[model samples]
Target chain A: MTAAALEAARVWLVVALTLLGLFFSFVSMVGVLRLPDLYSRAHTASQADTLGAGFGLAAVALTVGLAGAGFKSVLLLFFIFVTNPTAAHAIARAAFEEGIVPWTNGDERR
Target chain B: MADADPPPGDGASADGPVDSAETSGPSAEASDADATSGPTTSGPTTSGPTTSGPTATAGAIIVPVEPTSTLRSTIAHVAEAAANDGAPALHLVEIASWRDGDPESDERAAAAERVLERVAAWATADLDDSEAPAAADVEVVTAVIGADDYLFGADDYVRVLAEYAEENAADRVVLDPEYTPVGNTTLLQPLEFALSNTSLSVETAPVDRPTRRERFRTEATTGRFVALFGLSLAFYLLLGDPTYWFDAVTGVATAAVVSITLSRVSLDSTPAIPRTPMRIARGLVYVPVLLYEILKANLVVARVILDPRLPIEPTLNRMRVIVGSGLPLMTLANSITLTPGTLTVRARDSDLYVHSLVPWAREGLFDGSLERWTRFVYYGRRSARLPTPRERDDVAILQGDDATEELPIAAADGGAVGAGDESDGGDETDAAESIDDEVTDR
Candidate 1:
């Protein structure tokens, strides 16, 4: 592809990934609010949040174009991917240990 | 918490309350309980179940049944107390999480029955052996409660047990020291606290608990040390400039310190040369599959959350996995949690207690796609192609009964059917055994 075409494609890729990131983050927020208990809340807090962060980081990394900062962003993405679910697990486990029953269909929203 | 071995060890130790009795005493029990701090205090602060002499008169002692080593001792302790009270009814209750009409309800109920049966037999045996032969008549009533309800937290458990205790006119509740209904996550504190709010006095049976240190790997291998040193050095250099003399010096120093301190504990096992690199490459292949799953499930969960109707079923199910233990199990558990709509609530022995948000998610979990992938990652293609959890009869809905897929009694005997030991135990399953051998061969 030509230089102008390549640059345009890169910009579009960044925009799309950033938008996707924002969308997932918005969903995570809604999920945390709407989901009934700690266990369910963690589903969004970990998975949704990590995906959101992941897409956002990917966009940033692409925009920076494979240099030092880009590598750092990728590393940050890796850390978030590894740590996010673990944090959620710890929180859910704490809640479980505390004797907080998970909310099911019939139970009142907490 | 990330490790998979603690639960089984904890469960195994907790299940043998009989052994705990021999090891039990005021000094040993006190210091040990002090480390945990919650369950021990909650018990004695109330109507003084373990303190203030033997004639405390427990009208009915409700003991939540789990397969902990402390359970045998807890039963013996309760039986002794019951004997002192002169024929107080001993209620053995297993809190189940099931709706009235789940397809697996019968299987779940049968599992609960087996646990109760074993515990009741132990209780009867203990009573028979008691100094007070008159206490041999101690009525042992076992029932599975929470059958119709969705029990999620300590309050729910307390609510059900309180209702059961009230029905039986039980005044005291004796819990096994390691009575973590939801696997290794210790629920004793919250259960005790919640139960304290009720009329029934709560007490964690003063049994000898295995020290937390014993649960961890302590032996440092040369292979593990070298592997950790190499990885640490790589990580350090990656963060800093590889060409810088300062960075190289500091990196080596840091790597040495890390390897020296954590070589034994960090990695699950010693890294084999070509095998480790091969596994890493295969593991890299798994990332796309995992990411795809995450993306798809995220959309589904997001849609459900966004929908006005808010369609969510939120069921806890159990699946016995054969991804071996330690790092492999941690990988599977974390992957399950990372996938939206399903959260791994606990990992006790080979069983994963997963909470599924919707029917779609629950169905996905039962499908064992991720589990199969996990096996493929850890054990290889042949192991991955084995029967799905549903097909293998290793999956169950733990909602109603304390979903011990196999009885904890069997688990305590070191015969908990997992990986190699399929419950069916005959015929074509030699295929599974040979595969298990293949996995261990690594």
Candidate 2:
């Protein structure tokens, strides 16, 4: 491939990753607002948001091209992957322990 | 796949290395070879015929045998009890599960026998090790139960054990804290619960377990230290400009300090060539599969939340998984939580309490795809293709329409929280704020 074509491909990849990240983040926001109960809200908060962060960080890594900033972004992605689910677990565990009954089909939205 | 599945052997599967019997404490480690060679008990009763019948008196103490790190400690504890209470016979029982007329029945029986005999010898040794010459008088009898039966659930194992206890007139049961009759499945909770329903007085041996922090303190080898040092220096240089002399000098200093302080603490195991690299490669392969699932589930959950009716059938389900504990368990738990529509509320032993937003997600969780993937990552592909939780009848809906809800808050908490009592004023707004913080902070 030509240098210009390769550059264009890189640009396209970064853009695609960025858009996907934004889309996931938007879904997470909607789910947070629309979902019933603390437990369900936590699902979106941990899963969708973390995925969004992953894609966004990937885009940043690609833009920086495996250099100083790129490596740091990758590290940040790893930490987010580790911590996000754990934070969600902590929240869900606390709710369950506190007797916050999860919302079911018949129950009214909390 | 469920029926065609071979009967689980005696820790001979791909997960053999991680099995508590093979890898745990010094007691379990010391008996590894001796167990395979067959029973080496000096106790007269232990050497007797398998069908010698229950000669145990009412003072007989029953200790369920498993090659756990706490096995020796449990034996020592039982010996001390025997010394104090004047118990005549100490029964070492190992439950072996096999489908009636299954081809693997003999293998299962022989494995169970080996475990039982090994434990009997350990008990005898513990007694002999003690200063009391009277300790040698405690008869150790070994029995392999449930070999002829298709023992499926925790209740089945409990039934066989209770029957043995009753026949032997053994009132007291001393449990090794690490005992799990069915491999990798956490039956201690349900086993204890079911046994409690019977006349058996069950108590876990009061052996000291390594605390979470203490788990980090494995033997610090030079290979581990060097690996950690190199990793730290690379990470440091990656963040800063490696070409700069100042960064290089500071990175070296920082890496040295980190390797010195946290080298042993950070890595779960010593980094071995081929194994470590192969695991990393497999883990990398797992990332795409996980990301694909996350995306697919995210779209599905997004549609549900975006719908006008907001179609969701939230339920809490408890699934007993056989992916071995520690890092693999954490991986499965985290992977479950990171997938949309399923949130892992709590993980106790091998049982994970997951909250699913819809039936689709609940079914997926029971299907055990992620669990199989986790097993594949840690224990290889052969161990990956086990029966799903649904097939194994190891899942229970803890809440919603189909749920029995018989397990109260205390049972669910593993006795950590209040007993069957609901804490008033849960404060929903606080929880919502935490969720908000979690999202925005990320």
- Which candidate gets the maximum lDDT versus the true structure? 2
Write the residue-wise lDDT of candidate 2 on B79-137 in tens digits: 66653454567888877654434433566577666666666666655544433323444
lDDT of 1 by residue, A10-98 (tens): 99999999999999999899888988888888888875566898899999999987766788898897777777767877787666656
TM-score each candidate: 0.54, 0.64
Model 1 per-residue lDDT tens digits across residues B273-351: 7568877888999999999999889888888888898877676766777564556778888889889989887766566
Off by over 4 Å in 1: B1-220, B400-442
* Cα DockQ of the candidate 2 complex: 0.57
How many times do residue backbones clash in model 1?
26
Give the Cα-based TM-score of candidate 1 against the true structure. 0.54
